[model samples]
Structures are given as structure tokens and as C-alpha cells.
Target: MLVRCSLLLPLLVWLAPAQGALERVDDFALLDQHGEFHQLSRYRHMRALAVMAYSADCPAMAEMAAGFEDLGHTLSDRDIAFLFIDTQGLDRGQLRGLELELPILDDGGRLVSAALEFGQAGEVALLFPERLSLFYQGAAGAGFEQTLDAVLAAEVTNSIADSIRAPLEAGCPLEFPVRETMLAEAPDYAGEVAPRIIENCGMCHRRGGVGPFALDSHLMLLGWSPMIREVLLNKRMPPMQVDPHIGHSRDAQYIAAEDLQVLVNWIDAGAPGPAGEADPLLALAEAPAPGWQLGEPDYIVQAPRQDIPPVGVLDYTYEETELGLGEEKWVRALQYLPGDQSVLHHLMSFVTGEGEDFWGAERRQENSTRRFLDGYAPGQDLLREFQPGTGVRIRPGEKLSMQFHYVTNGQSTSDATRIGLYFYDEPPEREIFTDAVSTRFLLPPNVPEFPLRASRRLERDAVLTGVRARMNFRGKKMKFAYQAPGEPLREIFSVPAYNYGWQPYYRLDEPIAIPAGATLHVIGAFDNSISNPNNPNPDAELRFGVESWEEMFTGYFTYHHAH
Candidate 1:
């Protein structure tokens, strides 16, 4: 998408931009005109990414577009992706008219524009995604080709920095009104940036939380401003990487355009200390942790303790806990209290028969419906309460199957987790159910992206409440979409940059209604290559397995019957 870097860095030499030198550009993401998601860091498979600053108001827009199309064809064989960025805010309706084949990034707020220093339309930036180096910055025609040729020549010489070019002041100048205003007046630390941090990042970035550091003071903010900028630009923090252009979710961690503008602007403005003594961050950082968000549950089930080793990879462990329920109950919500969050990465729970495990019908069948309680990942809310009238029905003799996956954090620990079950006094009007859509394939070794799709047709009318994507180490990305009998395909959920460490069950803010004869689809791919950061071993020719070490593609749809 719109990955970038801006001027201003003293301590972090890696982020500094020297005159006539190759500058380091941070990563960012944005949706293109066709609703396709693109992120700079995700394109590690490519050698470089070329983006042109575009504005419809510019007079040379037509010729530049034509030349950019030619460059796209010229660089088609090369491992470079061509993209266009919109400095002026334009809706999809306005952009659809241009009908450009390239991904015209939606830079509505000018955040990425300001970060990348896109001062003029028709200006081009050639970026090396892996190294985050800027190879060239100049006008998008002859100079662009010359820089590309120089960069190619340097590849043979094994000297990338030698081919870098300085910025050329030729093109239609574009205006960034907010950046001008922000640059003029320093951002108020107490008023502007701290509140945004408290709201968006305070959850995990606190003292004892999972974050690497705590933002308890303004000084801490000032010290970690560069890293904060890095993570935000890369879409790494906020930890929830769902595309906002698609379906909305309450749990989706989204910062407003204005808020993002304020944050980066404040950071860029030397990150001055607080003008006033009042600091809101200290209170949130020192606050006591609350428990059982919905209050004490009707019944609490203790899971068997798992002993994690000091170091080494571990497969998925499955254990079933006997409920010993004398009577049946209508379950409303379940809360998972992880005993050891440091070692325990994530776990999945399911309501199963006496002898069944978490795999249930998934072992023999590629796709089947199952009873899914919850798929708990890091940074997710521990307490999950479903809609008022909808709850999974639990009967006597049913057991709770828990699957535990642990990641060693240089320490030995034992995790004896517990689950709090909230039950409805009476049977709910509607019953919540889950449909598991999965696929099995022998993934070839060292492949950058191996595409996979899994789909299942609905037997009747159903209202989809939530969706969860499941894959092992090599998982790259996954999207959930559906199509009715006569309607066009609609995307409901998307994990644009999937992280195996953060597989939180995404609950949609608004549920989608699907009629009978509709087909739900799960589209995704695996990156079994060195480009993938989380890939344990790209050379492993793996098949589907229940263990986290092996690979499995499964998309769970949580829905309720309409009738």
C-alpha cells in the first residue's frame, strides 16, 4: 500500500535520511481502487516497489498515466510492482472512471504522502521492500528508467547504494495542508498524542502487559517515538491488521485518520515534553487488572496443567475436561483465564462428545460443521459474550476439548488455565453454530505463495455472526467472502497480513444475512519461503496435520439459523 518514511531522526541512525544518500523508508498499508489490499512489507517476495504520486488536478496526469503504464509493462518481467498513490482524496466512484490497471493507493489523509514526501504529482519513488531503501526519487520518465538501469547494474556489482539518486524538482506540486499546519505549530503533547496512545496502545503496552515496553510517561513516549512511528507506519502495532475498507468489527483496532495524523505529526515535531503537569498515561499504566468482565460465572472448569520446556518447538496438545454436569445448561459466554501468557501462545476450545477431541470431524473430512467454543489468541478480550438470545446449547455427558499451543520465551513455566462458563437460565431463542471450511494439500518447498481456497454451501438461511481463520507457521493471508444464488460475491472479513501469533476470532459489528443456496468461501495462501518471517522451515514439504508445526487451512463461520 502506502509504506513510507519521513525526515527527522537523530538517535536512530538507521532511520536518518542524509542528503544525496539512499534514505530508509518505513512500511505502511492502504486499499487500492479495486478494494485490493497492498502493504509494502508484505511484498518481501519482490525486489522493489515503485510508486508514483498522482493527482487528477495535475495537467500532465494523462501523459504520466500512459508512461506509468509503459513502465509497468517494461518492468513486468522484473520482480518489481508498480503502484499509483492519490494525494487528493478521491472516492472509488471517481477513481473507477480512470480504469487504471495499476493499484492507485487511497492516501486520503495525506499521512503516507507526508511520510514519503510526495510533493509533486508524476514524481516516482523506487523502494526496496526487504531492505527499506530508496533507490531513486525523481520525475517518472527518462530519469526513472535511468535510475532503474543504474540499480540493475549495481545488482551485478553487489553495490546497491551506488545506484541511488537524489530528488529532482520537476513535476506538478501537490499541497499538503495538514502537514503545513502541523509543521507550523508544535503538537500539544498533553492534548494531542497521549490520549490517542492511551486509547489505542495502552492495553498491551503497559508495564506488565505483553508489550516490550511501557508507555507510563511522556518521557517514555519521547524515547520510543521512533519505534512507535515505525510500528504504526508498518501497521504492526494495534496488532489487529484487518482491512477497514471491508467489513467493520468492534474489536478491530483502528485509529482515525485525524488521530493518526496527530500522532505522527506530534512525533515528527521533536516529541516535546508535556507543557502541563497533568499526565493521563500514568493512571492507565498503574491501574489494577480487572477479572471476569461479565462477573463470576455459573460454573468454572479447570484445564490440566501444561509444563512448557525452557526451549524448543512444541506440537499442539489436546486435552479434554469432563464437565461432570448433573444437568444440561444453555451457555451464553465463556472466559479464558490463561495461567501463563508468556509461554502459552494460544488455545482453541470446543464442545465435543465424550471420546472426541478438538479435531472432531476435521481429520477425516475436508469440511464439516463442528462445535467451536472459542479460538483464543494474544491481545484479544478474554471474556466473550455472544448476542443476548443466541448461545450454544450444552447437554450432559458433553466434554470440553481444549487445544493448547505454547511458544517458549526463554523460560520454563507451567500453565493450568481455567474457563468460566456463563449459562442462560432458560434456553435461548436461537442457537449459535459453527461451520468449518478446510482444505488439504501437499505444499511444495521454498514456494513464495501457494494459493488455497475452501468453500461450503449453506443448507438453509443463516445469519453469520463471526469468522476465524486457522493456519500454522507458513500462513500468509486469508479472506472470508460469500455469494448468493443471484448476487455478486461479497467479502465479509480479511486478514490482509496474517500473523500466526494473533489469530483472534473476528466478530463482525454487523452480522450478514445469507439465504439458502449460498456458498461461503475462504481464500488464502501460504508463504513457504525465506521471505516469510514466521516460517519455521521453508524447505519442509508439509501436509495437513492437527499439530501447529504441520500446516492446516481452516476457516470457521459462526452463525445462527434464520428459521
Candidate 2:
């Protein structure tokens, strides 16, 4: 018989009406290892649900699975249900042989996985049927059995839970003590502050992070707390300078204001807290694994391996490959996995008919640029699935050209790059469009200031949709604005303080409306003197070129026109 836990009672009661936590999980369904459907409702009658988020091949997660199996055995007679969900699109076949005694579900879509707020590494949530509530949640450590026992003892009642029956009030007020606490009350360095740090700083500060060290454990945090506080107060940890009031959007690795405050208060209080229970949240199961998020790719095109000579600045290099598509092929999605993610800074992909010079086209003439299928930078996820019936097409005998910008790290290395292409036999519903803003201006040497501008007028009435600007460290400010044939101009996007390392493609929440025959303008300012820290040559005369040291003023726009 199922021994239901009181901790999950609230979630169960709330699950009935579908609101808040309950509502968030109602439509959740995921594909299991064998591509079978796994619905949350199927396990509704179980005493409790143990939800675990795992990555495909993370070493830390694989080791923790052994512990999870032990925990499952401990609760086997308690009628609890254990379900493992792979958060990063790893295939079941790859993970089939693992010695686990639970059903592992694949959350490739990330719908249910994200709804649970599952962090990157191991995270666990204990559900109670009595109040339909989450009794315990945290990363892996001790006290798991203690929390589980308490949740199981809580009695289940028929009264509707607040999350399910009651209308959610406006956001609840959060309270945190402002006064600093003494070191005696300080929480264990790992137990209290580790979770907060993992959520906020782990993404970029980890080994792969642009930072110098990884904060994967409590010892690392305690050692680096002083430096962490310095970086936070100085606003250097997160390297973007966007006016929050204007547009504060969510993305991977974004830290919330409240979370930031928690870090500040903890650091101010000398990071104090009582010894609570062990963290139930484990690191993402099977994390730090390698493989495609969407399983194996249908086709892989590897770039000719090239060695990076030790030392000196590296210029942009172009490598072209011939993908013999017998006929026009509709590309639904494409994934580019870097051979050496550490050294490869950025890559751009372009498609052209046989023997056409796509890059040369832009170099030879002003106001000249070719269409870009898609491009990727670090920390960027694959493009959202293309709209139904809409896909990028590559004609037969066309070449897939790639331009890679590499920064050497005093090591001799070669990269065999591969791009996975997913195609459809039929035409897509929507078409891909690219509009570029380019200039034909030159900059003189050692100039204190220079006005560089580029503008383009729409030949026909078209929507001015997504906008992204490109520039190097010498760039000061870039703004994209539009003026209708006879109307006042409005600025759509602006980067007042541009940083080359933090280049982002900013998409408007809503498409900006532009009238027919409107002119789109791109205004950019450059700082070529010693004042700019990123200037490669403060003394060299700067010219209009594609080189990073040289200046190029360009804005890319993606739009959809009425059929």
C-alpha cells in the first residue's frame, strides 16, 4: 500500500484546480527514454513524488545517482514514487545502462524541468500529499532521511490547499533581517550560503566561467567570499550595463534583484545562519556530460582542423565546406558544437550558391551584405524551434561558409568543428529575413573622436523587427532608430555603454511598428585613443575594415513581411 507523505498533501490538493504550483504542472508531459509519454497525473495516487533533475553526462551527477538509489531503497516500503528527469536534452539510449532503480524521464523541451525551478546540478524536491506542499528542497548533503520521515508523518487532510483553491494574491512581500548577525549564529559555510551562490554566481564564475576560479563547493566560496563581496559591490560580477527600468528581461544565468540582496546581506552579516538540515537538492544528475542536447545529430559537418600557434593576436579565419544537397533542402534547425569551447570565441554561418563569395560581397561594396542563416556566441542556447512550415533553405551545390574568431590562450590547439543540421522535406511556414546597416566611412589615426554613422531606407513597407548591433571594444555607443516617410523618429534600441565581451542580440518584446518607405538609421561613436582599454593599437591609424582593430558600423535586422 502507498504510504503518502504529508509534505506532498498541499501539492496534491492544489493539483486538482490547477493554479500556482499546481497550475504550473497541469499541462506537463515529457518523453521517457523509449520516446514514451510520461504524464504527471499518472503518478497522482503515489504517496509522494521525488523529482530529480539530471544532465546527460555530468560526472558529479553520476556519482550522486548511487546515493539516490540508496535513498530509493530506504523509502521503497513507504509507497513513494521516484522519477528522474533529464533536464539537458540527452538521449535515453546513451543513459540506458546506468544501474538505477527508477524511471528516468527526458525533459528535452525543458517544460516541466524549468517549471520545477530545477537548478543546473543536483536538486531534489519532496512532495507531501497532506498539504500538497514541498516539505524540503536543497542540494545534496545530509539530513535527507530526517526530512523524509517528517514529511511522511504529517497527516493528509481534505481541506483544499491555498495554492489550488485560493486565488493567488498579488506577489507576497519578502522579509529579510537587515541587521547583521554574530558569527555564532552563522550557518555552516556550505549548508547556508552554497545554494545562494550556486544560483547566482556559479554560472559564470565556474571553471568555464569567464572568471578565474570555480565556486562548485563550500570551501571555494569561503576562500573567495572577500573577493566575491568586492566584485558584487563594484558591479563587476555581471558584466552588462543595461538600464533596468527601460528593459530588464530574463535569460540563462540572470540573477534576480532579491537574490542579489540576499547575497549582499549574507556577506554583510558575515554569512550567518543556524545549522538547518542537509540540502535535499542534489547537483543535476549526470552533469558535465558531453553530447548533443537533442540526442545525436542527423548529419555532422566537421571543419578542417587547424592548429592555433602559441602566442600573438589571432585574426578572423574563414573555412568553407561543400554540403552536397542533391536538391533544395529545408533546414528546420542547426546545432554548432565547438571542438574546443574554451578557445573558440565566436562563429558566424552563411549559406551561398555554388562558388559565390559571401564574405567578399560585403567587403567589395558599401551597403552590401548577405543573408545570415544563424550565428552563435558563447552562453547562447540553440534558436527556439523555427515556426511551423518556416525553415532555412539551402539550394543544391551550395556551400556552408563559416567565419570563426579565435582568441589564443598561449597553447597550440586544433579544432575540428562540427555543425548538426536538422531538415524537413517540405517547405516551412515562415521565411527567414536579414537586413543590415553598413557604412562607407573611414577613421583617421589617433583621433580623439570620430562620428561614424550608417543608415538604410526600406524600399517597401516592411516591419522593423528584431535588432542587433555589432562592434569591437573601440565602440562607444550604438543606437538604432527609425523615421517614417514623414514622421518623427523613435529610437528602438540603444547601447549607451557597449562592451565587446557582452555583445547580445536584443529582441523587442513586441515588434516596433514602422510605416512604409521609412528610413532606419544606425549611429555609432568610436574611441580609438589610449583612453579605451580594449583598443589594440592606440597609435595605429584606424580604417574602415572587417578586422577587429579596424572599425565597422553595422546593425542587423530580422523581419517578417505579409504573405
Candidate 3:
């Protein structure tokens, strides 16, 4: 069973880099209640190693017994090794009554417990022994199931497990008698921890922002410490995390190792605030400016105020306004000013003809004209500007159709968002255009990797400015490529991992020039299996549809004619 024990450990040494936030568990051995030597090295061949920190005296441990038992059966069938380590200093007499059928290793010295640093009962750490790294360290809950599914997927695909997957443990705190002696210094909230939170969390977590709640004071942070810790450890708070090894984007949100340690350490050390100290979070300047970042808009189109109910589903709202352009106008840039940013989910604007609703007379206007002018969503507030010699054209008497998608927050509110456009005196040398490479495919149920492809041949010499991908929950990965005649296809951009919630338009650093006959290709795959944590139903056969619940495969491309 341990044939490659020596070779694998040394080969997987580079899996966990020295500077990462990953807290690797040291290998140790212990005798189970049955006097069977359960060693860590002996389980390297398994898909994963699940270690449950159990305490016979803790009531929380007893409450989690059913969950642990269910997980043991599920993991064993999936080829995952599971075991329990007793952290409490309970004697055999006290444990005999519990009658846990699972293998319970006695950690009389609390050596294994201290090494994993699980503070509470019912916490489990998922380890990938093949890589000699910790895949997930968190409490047993719904989040644990999601993490386990992700681990299993990674195992099947032979992909690297996410380094940060520790959800906050929810259980009675274990009284590690030696822990009190180990904490000699308390982390000051104002001096050490506040700066870190303000830098990383304060932007979205402030009042009237997109965050669910505020973290503007020491008291507020303390009150929400458990949630904050959970999001931070699980790598869920700082959204749209890009794999550092794959590529780097300015929009990527990643927490540094040193900063993460400061927050986690302070929370673990009892979240102390110095006596009579001023709140740093309150003292910090507000991040969002009252006015536009690009000074003032050349022309601002104010959208009609929308009344959002406290609850229930809401349909898409459509509004139109006449631009009344006497002559052609060249728009250089555009920005969205959302009145109630919290309730606003997304906004899509299109330049259509007179009396046109969402779609033109044909009812599918997107196919008729390159009408999708701009879009706005959370964390996608960057000012959209065309290339130096390119701009979007607005003809005389053209109307702007606005489509709003709002999500209720259990409160009655309204939004009057304004679309700001900056125009140039003269038309640019080239006119920018937006096109999409899309396809419709019926997805079979429980298919892990369903490949799809779509391509469009260019009609004119153009420069590819940017690319963006759109898909529903089943979307896994997408890449954009172009093939010139008599030349090999070359991938220009790739979204290795696609999260439905985060769809940012990635701008190319260097624009690619393509001839009129070049074919642009968009290729991707979908995961409709049970392993997909986001899949609404693994058994439901999905088809191409316009609703969010349904599936769609489209890759948006922004380009301009090379006049």
C-alpha cells in the first residue's frame, strides 16, 4: 500500500510553496482504540484523508456523530480514507459508553490535535496525501459538503486542490489547557488587524456597499468575527480569485499570506481591542467618491427610478430614451452611475432604432445589429474606453434601451442609475463593433465534460480589443482563438476557470490584427455532474435558453475595423 511513500513525499514537496498561507499538517502516528497502528504514510494511495478532531466530553462532538457516520460511509465508497482523533484527555472508561463505530485514535498527549490546530470539536481537515498538502480544513457543515465535492472533482480530473478552503469551524471550543500559556501577546485591533481589514475588506463591507453587512467598527467586526473568519479562511470573501500560477489580471482579488495571517491570528487570539482606542475602521476615509472618477461626464442619461419590492421574484424592466442626435456622434467612453448599488444586480444598455423595445421589429435585435453598447455589474465599474483610433458611432435619432435586473434584499428600495457617455468632436479612424460567437447544444444529464464550439468568419480587417465569456452554472472553462487562412489557430485569451457570478470583460494588452477571412473560434466545456457544486440539478437535462436557470454558451468579442 505504501510502495511509493518515500518517492511521493519528496516529489510533492513543491506543492505547498514556502510563502503560501497553506498550513500543512506534520505526519504523525497513533494507536486506535482497537490497538491498530494507524499511520499517515500508509494512506497516501487513497483519494483523500479525512481527519475528524473528536472529543468525548464535548456535547458538540456527540451532536455531530450522525454527520460523521454518514460522511464515513460516503467517503469510504469514494476511496477516501476517514478516521477520528480524540483530542480531549478522556480515559477509556469515559469513551467506552460513546461506542463510536469509526476508528478513534487516542491522542493522550494532544500532539496530533495541536499540530492540526483545530480549536473546536466537529472540525475536519481534508488532506491530499499524494501531494503532501492540505486540501481543506474546516467545520462539518454544508460548506464541508461543497468542499468535499470540489476535492473529489479535483481528484478525478488530476487537478491541484485549492490551497485555501478552510471554512470556520462551528462547535464548542476545546479547552486546550496548554493554549493559555502559549499566547503571550495579544494582537491589537487598532494597530495590527484593523489596517489589514480596511485594506482588504473595508471597500465592499462598508455601509451602503455590496457587502451583506458592515465591518466599520471594532465592535461590528467582533460581532461578525465568525462569519468574517469563515469567508477569509474559505477564500470566498475576496471574490473572483485568479490562480496565481495561470495568469494575472488587475481585476483579480487575492489575499497576501502575511495579511491573511494577521487577521486569522488576531481572531484566534480572542480579537482583542485596546482600551479606549479610537476605531481605525471609522477613521479610514471613504473609498467611493461622491463624484465621477473621470471628472464629469460629457452627457449623462438618467434612467427612470425603479421601485423594488421587499421580496419575491421580479421580471426584467425595460426603458427607452431618444438620444436625438442631430448628426453622428463618436462615443469614446462610458460609465454607469447606480443610485442604489446594493439592490442593483446588473444593467445592460443597447443602442436601438426609434420605438424599439428590448429587441427590434424582428424581436431578436441582437442578431440584426451590433447593438449591445455597454453593461454594468458589481466590481465591474471600470470606465470603458475604445482604442486610441477607434470609437462607437451613434446615428441621428437613435434610442438607447436600458434593461435592469434587480435582486430584492428583503427591503423596499429604488434605483435611478445614470449612464454617462464621453464623446469626441470628430469620428475616429475606425468604428468599434461588438460581436458574439455562440452555439446551442442540448446538454445530457450528469455529463462531466461536454465540449462545445462556435466560430465566425470576419467580414472586414479588424483589431480584437477585448473578450468576455458568458455561461450558466455548468460552465467550466473557455478560450478565444483566431485562425488565419493557411495558418495554425492561435489562442488569444483563455478563461481557465469560469465562475457564473463574475463575468469581467478582459482587455487585451496588445490588440491582434486579423484579415477579413480569419475565423474566430470560442471553445469551452460544461460540468453537469453531481461533482459541480453550483449545478442546480445533476439529473435535469439542460438546454440553451435565455433564463438564468437554463444554460447558454456565448463568447462576446469587442473589435473595430482596421480602416
Candidate 4:
């Protein structure tokens, strides 16, 4: 026998006829399965927005799915944005298995479900976003068709649609059993919630850290609760996260489900701070400063001061500093020190030609053929040490060029970032080289998933020490594989869920060996449709380019050629 939680009693009691003026539905945002952010306000240009609360387990969904798809077809010509939101904690794997025509959005914590007051699975809510009012909230059968028709014709204006209450549909309750249980005993903030933040977010969210704001106090956290909640539930925080089932990395930051629930539940519970409780986060803020993890360096070089304006986009700041090396040098490890973490998007250094300074196509003719030394981005390991005998070589006269990508943080500031290098007493037996495995492809406008491929054949035996995928907002996923002499191709590293915000070098725990003649292949795709939230202009045909808004397909391989 099917059972339902009793929490639906109060929810049903509050349900009322949609005959009078309806309250404006608050603006909300959620990421679809395709990783595109869909905010209700962004779709105001549409005639109307149809949001359906969906679940796979409900038997009624089978009956309603075809109706929802049909409604989408009918309204597509009318400029109505149709979306299905998944309230259940469904992962990408489960979502992929479901037969869903409409893009399925993952609302991990049911935050949107609670906000919209979803009564049951397969409930359809029609909203007139321009007027900021709920047009109709009920079943999608006859009443939805009527409202959609009326809204499409001149019958129902934005104001008139608010007063039409569609009849309710019978369906299984969308149970949020945890909310009821949490109500009995609220999650303790200091004991349970704060510790999660400290463990998962403290590394970069503390004072002098890269995070835009500090999360070191109860008051501070409560103030930023809304933004924090959004990023966490959307899986944006603790960047460099991967699908654990696909691959594993020692540096990957995977937050436990229970820990995430504790924080989100605490925020949902109003973020109350008990009286007389000492703040652990505040105490952590006073702990001793974290010195260099690799100790004092052999040499340090700082870039020129980069003036950042109060607003507007700034082109990449390029500066060149001569290493003044008398002889060849071997750098075992190096670390970057960003002058201003808030605005520094990333810093890239290269061993460039004598006059080739910057790293964009617009800057120099030789920018595409330069040597990549190292780079630093948020959450990436800055102080990277090479294997026992392998190190990055520095030619005697090779100059270092720094390209700074600074994002505006709503404030004017300047930066003089520095790089610390530790050299070995003697050159290592093997030297590491960084090269890109990429191909050129055009992405048509409004295309959802366009496949692209790039490969390189090993000229000499080498160990693939690490790999980093490079793509702008439209990049979907990148996988690295190698086909050995007589063996089937095997996957080495895969960024199945690529995020433009965080691009970290995924170092292999055990480097894989590739003999000469083995081919290393890179596979990925691009999402250049309305579904890609990060795509700047889905209507614009995009080709490979250096600008952030443009698109590119490149996979960087870090390997040491065998002697």
C-alpha cells in the first residue's frame, strides 16, 4: 500500500480558489540538467512562463507527461517558456534515465519547491511573469488549456489571468518528509552547520582568502545566506567538483550529502544564533596566519601594478619580466601570490619569445604558439611540485610573461601579483612539457550539444602527469583517453561536468605511460542554445577566440617525455 506523510494537511488547508488577485510569484532560479541557469526574470520577454513540478515515481506523471509536451508544442509558437522542475534529489544519472522531453531542472534541496508551495507531483503552474502574477496554478488538463488559450488570444490579459483559478488535479503528494522531521528538532548551527562550512569552505572563504566575502561569523553568514544557499544547492561551491562515479581525484572537493543538508537546513530554519554560544568561525579567523606551504622560495618575481577601474570590462593585463638566468635552471616547484584575490580571475605565465609579451590573439601574432609555463586560478593548486626527477626547464634568456584576467568585483583596485620559484641544485633526468590537444570547429547558433574532437600522437614515450580542460561558458564536458599499441583505448581523466568558473589541473595520482605511436584523444561538446546559461549570445555563431564570451576547444596535457 502507498503511504503519504501527514505534512500535506496544512498545505491542502491553505489551498484556495484562484478567482481573485493572486500574489506575485517571487523570482527564482534553478539549473537544468544541461547546466543552464534559468531565472524566471530572465524569461520575462516571453509571453508567459509555464512551470511544472515533476517527479518520476508518481504514476500520474505518465498521464501528464504527454500533455505537458503537447502544451510546450502549442506555446512554443507563442513565445511561452516551458520548464519541468525536479523537486526530488535526483542526480544526473537518474535524470538521464527518465524519459523527459522538457528540460528537467534539478532543485536539489527542494528550496524552489517550498517557495512555490508545490502540493503534488505533476502540478502545473502558469505564470504571467511580465505582470509578476500567477495566472493559474492547478492541473494542466482542461483549465490549463483554457488559460493558455485565453492568454494566447486577446481574452486573458496579464491582469485578467491572475483572477482565473483552474480546477485542481488529483495526484500523489510530493512528500518533503525531512521538513517535518527538521521542524521537530532544528539543525544546530554552531555544532553541525558551521563545522561543515569550516571543513568544506574555510580554505578559501576566510579572511585574506580568495572568496569575495568572508564566511567567518554567524552574523556574516546570515547576511550572505541567500547567495550561499543558491551556490551550494546548485553544486557551484567548492569548485573543481566532478561526478564521483565517473572518476576520482585526491584534490576533488565532494561535500557529503548530510553535511550539505545540515547547512541548508540551518539556513532554512532562519539561521538562529543561540545566546551565549561562542562563534567557532570567529575564533578560526584569529588563528595564526598560514605561511607559505613550500617555505621560502629561491627567487621571487613580481608583476607591475595593474590598475583596475571601478566598472566595465578590462582587457587582459600583460606584463613581462626577464628571469636574468645565467644558465639553464630547473624549477622543482612554484607558487603564485595574487595581490587582490577578489578581482583576479586567473593568472597565466609563459616562457615567451624575447618580444612576445601578452597571451591573447589580439595582443600579438605569436600568441598562439607560445610555451605555457604554469597558471593559477581559484581552487587550483598554486605550489605545484613535479615528480622526483622531473622539473620544468627554464632557458637562460627565456623571459616570463604574465597575463592577468581580472574580473570586476564592483570596486576599483590595483594588483602587483608575485610568483615564487624554488629551483633544484641539479637538473632532473626528465623535463616536463605542456602542450594542447585541440581542434577547430564552428558552433552554430541555438545548437544544444555540438560534438568536437582533438588528438595528438605521441612522438616519444612519455608519462601523462596531469591534464586540464579549457573551454569558455559553452563547454559541456572533456574526456582524455589514449589508445595503446594493441590494447583498446582507455580513459585517463574526464571532466564530465566542466565548469568555466573553476579550471584546475587534475593531476593523476599515478601517471600513465604512453609509448611512441600511441594517440591521446580529447573529446567534448558545446552547448550553444538557450539551455546554456553561461552562453553570452546563443544567437551568435561562435568560433575559436580568446575573449571570454567567445568559444574555444582545447585540452592541455602535462607530461614528461621519456629519455
All candidates: TM-score = 0.90, 0.59, 0.63, 0.76
Relative to the true structure, candidate 1 reaches a TM of: 0.90
**Model 2, 429-499: lDDT tens per residue?**
65656677778666665553566778777776555445667777677567777888668977776655456
Local accuracy by lDDT, each model: 0.79, 0.57, 0.69, 0.72
Q: Which structure is stronger by lDDT: 1 or 4? A: 1
lDDT of 4 by residue, 306-415 (tens): 88886886666778999898888888888887787667778877776565655433232211323566778765566777788988888888788876778766678888
Give the total clashing residue pairs for model 4: 0
TM-score of 2: 0.59
Off by over 4 Å in 2: 1-196, 199-201, 207-212, 225-236, 245-256, 268-287, 295-298, 306-313, 354-360, 407-414, 444-449, 461-465, 507-513
Evaluated at residue 92, the lDDT of candidate 3 is 49
What tens-digit string does per-residue lDDT give for candidate 1 at 1-563? 23333442222232223332346776877777866667777677777789998899889888988889788888887878899998887876677777887889877677887777777888888887777667666677566776676545445212323223445466688888887788678678788778889888887667655565789888788889988887776667778768777798876777777777788877877787777678867865663544787888999989999999878977778899999888888889989887876666678888998667778999889888887887676667888898889898777989999888787756677888889999998898888889999988999998878999999999899999999888888987889999999899999988867778777778989999999899999999998987787987888999998677789999999999987
CA lDDT of 511 in candidate 4? 86
Of candidate 3, the 10-residue stretch with the lowest lDDT total is: 1-10
Stretches of candidate 1 above 4 Å error? 1-21, 91-94, 153-158, 161-163, 166-170, 306-317, 340-345, 377-379, 405-415
Q: Put the candidates in TM-score order, highest first.
A: 1, 4, 3, 2
Task: Give the candidate order by descending lDDT.
Answer: 1, 4, 3, 2
Assess candidate 4 and give its TM-score to the true structure.
0.76
